[model samples]
Target: MAEQGAPQRRPSIHDVASHAGVSAATVSKVMQGVATVKPANVQRVFDAVERLGYRMDPLASELRRSKRRIIGAVVPEFESEFFGTVITELERLAEQRGYALVAASSRESEAREKEILARMHDWRVSGVVLAPVRNERSPAAAFMKASGMTGVMIDRVLADNAFDTISADSAAASAEVARALVGNGHRHVLVIGLGEQAATVHARLEGFRAQALALAPDMRIDVILSESDVAPLRASLRDYFGKGERPTAVYSLFLKGTLVALSEFRRRGWHCPNDISLVGFDDAEWMQVTFPAIAAVVQPVRRIATQAMDLLFRRIGGEEGPSRALLEPCKVLMRESVGSPGGGARAGGGDGQ
Candidate 1:
């Protein structure tokens, strides 16, 4: 007695059972491929399901099967080679351990990250791995803690101290690089792209300034915050390079700022290490192939990814332990970007002439 042109709702298991002349319980058993259902009835239920377009919910089915098999990975940016490598390694490890990884990018926005976490929660993911934003805490972090969801943090740590963290030794690494530059006879050095209060950046700045000042008491150390943009950095570098009091060497804290500094130098036809020595954090694939390869502090991406997955799995298994803090060393790659005080070869280039 339904209206002829009325829209129809998709069928459910009850509709399948009614059409197949079986109980709802029988339909469910057959749909689940239980051995107790008669072969003929199973076939009939399957036919009814196909006809009605009835589909089983994956999360519900997974729960019924009692499998803790899904984990979520949230990162700030997917376009960066660094995060891409982390995701790739995590996925491979997850698959090896009979688990699946559902990865999402926060795009460096708190609201977007919160929504992604909600979606992952709806999917009944067993655990989560996150690289929180540099300055702000993610809403998802508190939610995950409240919901009893297991999680591990990579790269930046959340301010709440609710989740385990695995990060590179930013402070120590930056200090070593500063020492290297100072050891090479560079007196005045500049560090770029870190905010004054950013934990990672602050640590690096502390180390760099401490070491530079320790080596030469009269050292002039300058720190420039990038404000997350390249134009200001380019302008600053250009102005500094044009000035007669430019730092003997420049150390860029982030990849984007590093690239901007390199491009600005190249555009102005200034040679690296010769005119002004440069060093940057994070190594990229093309770094070694550039005109003059850039020196970098490289973090072990694969190892960090693997350890994060392991911690996430253990937490999902209801293992109770203190929050973990891991610090991996950064390997410094020596290239043509660093040299002595008078420049490696172009010392007498006459101050941006």
Candidate 2:
């Protein structure tokens, strides 16, 4: 147990050189049988290396002899649990496979995303996993194609049928959540979130609307396109709810959008599952801890990332052919958020508020 707490890595050539008070090149010369290395300096280097139990990083040396082994990944957001977990897991896998990861958050900007791709290309990264800014033929894709780096797209794909792609089965997940809401007696539903931007968002909205309308043909579904800045969201929420009958249920399409909805509900002094029901598309840890413990569609973040990494590795290994796509399903976490249209929290359950 005590040993477990100690540093796991063996001492490196640099460490040995530092201990011997010599240059790394001097130590390298000693290791490579350079006769010009003074016997005394060589002896000191050997002594330091033995004392520290140092070993050469063979993979690092070999990769230098071959090519850059760094994999670049760019995501739209980082503070969210989903992207954070997926990127961290990919980094772990990359390190295990003797490759390095250089990750960046594009913050959902096309310009920033393109810049990241350009920088990664200049650095000659072995591959890249990109969560693009839009679902279209982008300058970023053109950059990747011209650079010839094995690229695997993640989260929202920018182009379909042209490259390896991996993402959550958002359409299925949306349909599932829509069914849950409709079945729970939510007749008038308000769909608000940042889902009007990309292909992933469009698919989710289409799936939810289709399934929900099929379930209850008479059900009403309204939408308010949300901006990242909460001020616009607040204005939209106030404008929509002020003029019309309050929605029986509010469905937030993204994690950040869910937060905006929660804040608006609080500002209005509204109680969930009492006067209005709430359901969000993306799950968050705090979502389960908050008042009414909001129900959400839980994305298979780890599975999607694993599949993406697998595809990226295949692409890096020179797998040639048509693009591949893996669509994994998301699950629903039914908490105390949704209930009947006019009724409060269900019997036997404490209102989270």
What are the per-residue Cα lDDT tens digits for candidate 1 across 161-215?
A: 6677887788878878877787778888878874444556776777788877887
lDDT of 1 at 57: 59
Worst 10 residues of 1 by lDDT: 344-353
The runs of at least 3 residues in candidate 2 whose Cα sits more than 4 Å from the true structure, single-residue gaps closed, are 1-66, 346-353
Clash-forming residue pairs, model 1: none
Q: Which portions of model 1 show Cα errors greater than 4 Å?
A: 1-61, 65-68, 135-137, 158-161, 194-197, 239-245, 345-353
Q: In terms of lDDT, which candidate is strongest?
A: 2
TM-score of 2: 0.80
List lDDT for all candidates, in order: 0.74, 0.77
TM-scores, one per candidate: 0.75, 0.80
Q: Across residues 239-309, which tens digit of lDDT does each residue of candidate 2 receive?
A: 87778658888888788778887787778888888878888878888988887888888888888887877
Clashing pairs in 2: none
